[model samples]
Target: MAIWHWIEQTLRSYPELAIFLALAVGYWIGGKKFGSFSLGSVTGTLLAGVIIGQIGIDISPHIKSVFFIMFLFAVGFGVGPQFVRGVANDGLPQAVFAVIVSCLCLFSVYLAAVLSGYGPGLAAGLLAGTQTISASIGLATDAINRLDMSADQIQAQLDAIPVAYAVTYLFGTVGTGWIIAYLGPKILRINLQEECARYEKEMSEGEPDGGMQSAWYQYIVRSFKLTKPDFIAGKTVAQAEAGMTGGERLFLENLRRNGKIIEFDANTVLQVGDVVAVSGRHETLVDWSNRAEEVADQELLQIPIESIDVVVTSKNANGKTLLELSKSPCARGVYVTRIRRGSMGVDIPVQAQTKLHRGDIVSVSGSRKHVESVIEEFGFADRPTSVTDMVFVGSGIVIGGLIGAIVVPVGGIPITLSTSGGALIAGLVFGWLRSFKPKLGSVPSATLWFMNSVGLNVFIAVVGITAGPTFIQGVKEVGIELFFWGLFATSLPMLLAPLIGKYIFRFDPAINLGCCGGARTSTASVAMVAEAAKSNVPMLGYTVPYAISNTFLTLWGMVIVLLLG
Candidate 1:
């Protein structure tokens, strides 16, 4: 009774905190148990805010604004560097495709909204911003103020837009990805795996081998070796060579401390402890070992070891020298034994001062648990999707950004929205236009998920708080009509844009899904398609598109309001 009373009191005192807690709990439970319920952190939080409002709770606008700013800054920092790289590498191809797809999707949504009898400016704003209803409402309200709409009318219209947009995002993410996945293969006539492989090849170009060769070498040592039992023990090099017939070359490698071997020379002497490699037939080596075993012990003391590959994903470790990370709390006991970079399968000895890059793959050998724990601690997980398709996707971003900056005008303005956004659009356009060219690079799915979560949470918090006390009244007035219009605007693009992806550009379903998710700035839906297809490559396939879409959505809202108002 005391705990319950405390809870009730706390809820009353901090209603917004309660709402956030409730949302966190709901998403955690739902994401774990029901796969479809993985609306991600941002989407879940926003939905919670809405639920709180429906139940008559109010949160301060100031708090929401602060959180939104922080979230956006984090997102910008995380993606900014990669965005620049994408543009530099392949600017033209990415630009053309990104612009076309973004324009088509935006146009389709705007046309449907206008035809459905919505206000032109509001429809244009909403569609331009990828159905970001709050941004739309904010822009629309400002436009209304300029046109002399009453304060009451402006507040009323703004209140209901969140609910409408939320519904649109939910349907837009799942529906668009689903429709594209099913219809994309048939319409595009391209195998999903083939497309993914093309992208994977590009990303794989500069990555490290992660110690596959070392393991192979170890395997060879164990599989076809002739072992001798102290054959050179107590024998001088001259004595040991006296009975040998073949002109075989002998080498000593991987010698341990206090270990010694008789050099293959007439004047050299042998010691009891030696590790040597002899080149001869397997049968002769075994016979020699057996013969020598009678005079000594039959044991050959070589410890068996293997190698494994690990790729680094976290930015915290990316630019630091290996020596630096190795000395940190994160690199305890995990020695980087070898590195294989690019197409050469050669194993280079690990250097302490080697700087880690984001996409560098490494081979590490240690106990299984130790390796696993270190990889997890350092955020080194398998990103076959990103690795496989980074090249074309990266090229697309660069090409698209360059072209969009030069040619595509935002309301006839000659300014670039965001370099990363342009790059992303370039990726999407290239993915669509040159379906045969293959994808070039990849980004970690977890990273994308994190970005989406942060962005959405900030967006929702800002929208919810701004709506405030007038929310209920506004919803009662315009909620019904706006709901249908929002649905129409969302669904039309969901249906039509993918059709463009399939028939016109002949892109895969993943591309279509990515386009919708990107346009709306929804990460949950993008993640869902990747998860369902059991391929992270597709997730990356959609990344540039989604990025492009988000860039346009975020910038276009401001641009449309500035121009139209």
Candidate 2:
């Protein structure tokens, strides 16, 4: 009994430890898979925090706010490039679809609240639940505070929010995942794998492995022997490569003559009986090999070849792409093996169309000479570093907080972004700016992941603990009405999302589901959808809409609360 009391005392005295425990437990639980469905970290952490909070281990709101702001900024920073690309001309339609889906979610919340005789708090909770956006809970609460009400009435309204949110959000997360993963394909009447294959065939590119994000990093190496009817013979390497067209333009990496490998240059001309090695996309290299006299042995071509990660610091490669650089004469001797954008996400395949940003650590493979050529054309090779740029990160947060402090009037209500939102906005600008000038910010990928994942979990863990006191009582008061309202809210927007996306906008089935997930701001659902599709093709539609909807839906949560609550 003494030991138990001491442990409880320790937990209460240092709530940060308790909060971290919840995160660790929740993350572990979230990773456990049951067949096709898995409870994700976000949901798992919230529940874990709730249980811990119910025990009397709780942190201050200020700590929660700090973590929340950190999370928003990292998210904004990461999505900066995608957000910019999505709003452009070619990407405009997907953005519109996402917006429409968000509006639909807003309408569904209003319709659900009005029909159910729910108050402003419940109404706002319905919106947050249906969208599966946890940020909405805070935004909705903020909006309620701005309303003109008696102290007792305000307290009552504020008290109603968490119960309704707590009930609906759980289903909101799981149900959205199920709908996109299972129900989406049934509605469209298509096999997801087949559809993705078709899309790949149309593009003439290699297939995506699950949702690796991009195919640009997918590469292959093949060796060819020079012979008669070979344009490469007696011609300079650059000139020979330039003569090839389409996917046949392979990067010449090595040349073997007289049982020895010789140095190559732009002026180094190929000779008969000389075997040369080329590296590029599998499809490109395969086709290039077919046009050769004979495919040589792999051993000679493999000599002294190495892969190195290069940092894109040169202004020339900042706005360009791996595909463009791959096609350039300088890139003919090397293959861009993979890309790590801002140290986040798995290395995406090198696709031709994916834009290059400054500071992107790109993996290129070839001989020392060819690698140097690629480095000269793009930027410098990456240096090893585990340390994060603290100065840059702190500055971004401060700037974001300042930005969030600015207020704007909407129908004379005096609206303003919370510190988190403002920081997110600032992070977006900082990230985008970093793409142009590689030296500006240096938040390591590992650090960004920590800020994004752990930060969000910590914020929600605090919320769950804080809400734990009134949680059960609130649920009982609302009865099952909140659950049904959540069901209605969750189901309606999804049903309408794909229907409108497909028939009205003519989005591909894979893309339509992605748009639906994005509009609802359900990243978990998007992941499931991409998994079901067996391709990252859906991501082409998901990213822009996800960015647009995340910002809008979070705002709408407050907007609906202000108008109807």
Candidate 3:
């Protein structure tokens, strides 16, 4: 006991050490799963920090704010392009369902707040806890400070918020996690593993078969030096490639004869000594090389391979798919190596059916002349430089920060988006713009993940630590009744989620539960949904609604207080 006390004292003396230890231990705890249910890093960190703080650990509040905002920005940036596309596409129904869930959450919070006769502080805290929007604490606090109340009244009300939050927050997390993971599958009467397989098979036609089966797509371009194979001696370039079959198609890039490069033509007859560079996947190229005689020129083998960034600006390519666009006559002799849409790069293994939005910047690779000609058909081609324009990102964040500071009065209730919310909006806009110009804002996936996962956990850990000491006392004041009321707020919205998602939105059970979890901003619930369904199909339904739900649910903290108080 003495040694334990001494260790606690030592950690208290250095706040940074306390925070680091909390993050490490909390993350380890979060990874622990029991039958496909895990607490997740954010929730684990919060619980750990609360326990540590209860025993007298501490960290600076400013550090928590910094971490929280970074998480918001990363989440908004990662989901921005998808959120934008979802609003107008197949995801629209999910988006509308998410709005329905959020409104219901608000209504539930108010119903519980009214029935329990909660003061302004408890009402706001209840909103935050049930919705799992931690930022609401600060925003609600800000709103309270502006209220026309005496010092003592304000102090008493302010103190109640954290107490109410602590009491309800845990169930808000765990209860929803269970409902989505265990109960959803049972209610839907579906077998997760079988359904995922069936869905995958149905969706996989014409898509690139990956792994060992993708050998045909593992293409290489080689310069063949012509020593005459009598078989193809007098055949034209097209005729030479026409005899190939089975694995993949072959295309002649160009012919090099007498120090000049000629574009391949069906009519251009190949001479005995003509050198041709041919491009095709491994299977086709290898098959052709076995019969054709070889000659290698250093310069020709090292053909100037360049990438052109072509923006999709016209209606012809706007809603058409990448596979469809690739087959256009204009796409001859060029390969789409990558498609960059802002911070997001589509994982196009064989998902060639992915629609190209108007602003998409596709990276096409081939010889310089061919790339130019191919790019001209898609849109204007620009050589996207490695340099990321930081000015655009900086300005957007700054403007967003400024915009968040303005408190608007709606029906005589003052409200503001806050800096964090503003940054999220800024990230979304900037991310969307990057999809078009692609010359600006170079945030990558790794960085976004780091900011989101690390940032949210750190903020949560700090909150738990800071809220720990007062936690027991606060719970004592509110009594267990607040918890049951919180359970009502938490359970009702989630219970209604599956019904609304499946029947109204006509989504499968996997997607409905995912939508429900996402609408609540609960990653733990989504993870549970994926685990229960034994497939990532839920995640497809989760993304857009998650983005939209996170933003609105966060703002509703203030809305609940202002409207219902």
Q: Report the number of the highest-TM-score candidate.
A: 2
- Give the C-alpha miss distance for residue 264 in model 1, angstroms: 19
Q: Candidates sorted by TM-score, descending order?
A: 2, 3, 1
Clashing pairs in 3: 219-281, 225-295
What would the per-residue lDDT of candidate 2 be over residues 371-453, giving only the tens digit for each residue?
Answer: 78777777776556678887888899899889788889878777788666788788878877775565776777678889988
lDDT of each: 0.46, 0.72, 0.70
> Residue-wise lDDT of candidate 1 within 1-565, one digit each (tens)?
9996777567657866665665565466336535555554444555555554443455554554333333333343333333332344332233334556556556655565556655434454345334542333333333344443566755544554454454455545555556556544454555655665555445344333443222112111111122343456556544553445364322222222243322255454444445433322344455455543322211322423335666555657655666566545334324566553211112223444345544345776643434665576554544345333445434544554455445345565444433433443443343322211122234444544443354446546545544545555645655566656656655565556555655666554444555444444455555554555455555433434443444455445435434433
In terms of lDDT, which candidate is stronger, 1 or 3? Answer: 3
For candidate 2, give the lDDT of residue 459.
77
> TM-scores of all models?
0.54, 0.78, 0.73
Regions more than 4 Å wrong, model 2: 55-58, 119-121, 141-161, 189-193, 205-304, 308-326, 336-364, 368-384
Of 1 and 3, the candidate ranking higher by TM-score? 3
Once fitted onto the true fold, the runs of candidate 1 whose alpha carbons sit more than 4 angstroms away are 1-19, 22-40, 54-59, 91-95, 116-154, 189-253, 257-273, 276-462, 465-484, 491-540, 563-565
Compose the digit string of candidate 3's lDDT tens values, residues 440-521: 6666445666777788778777766777776677778775899999999999988888877877788865467777887887
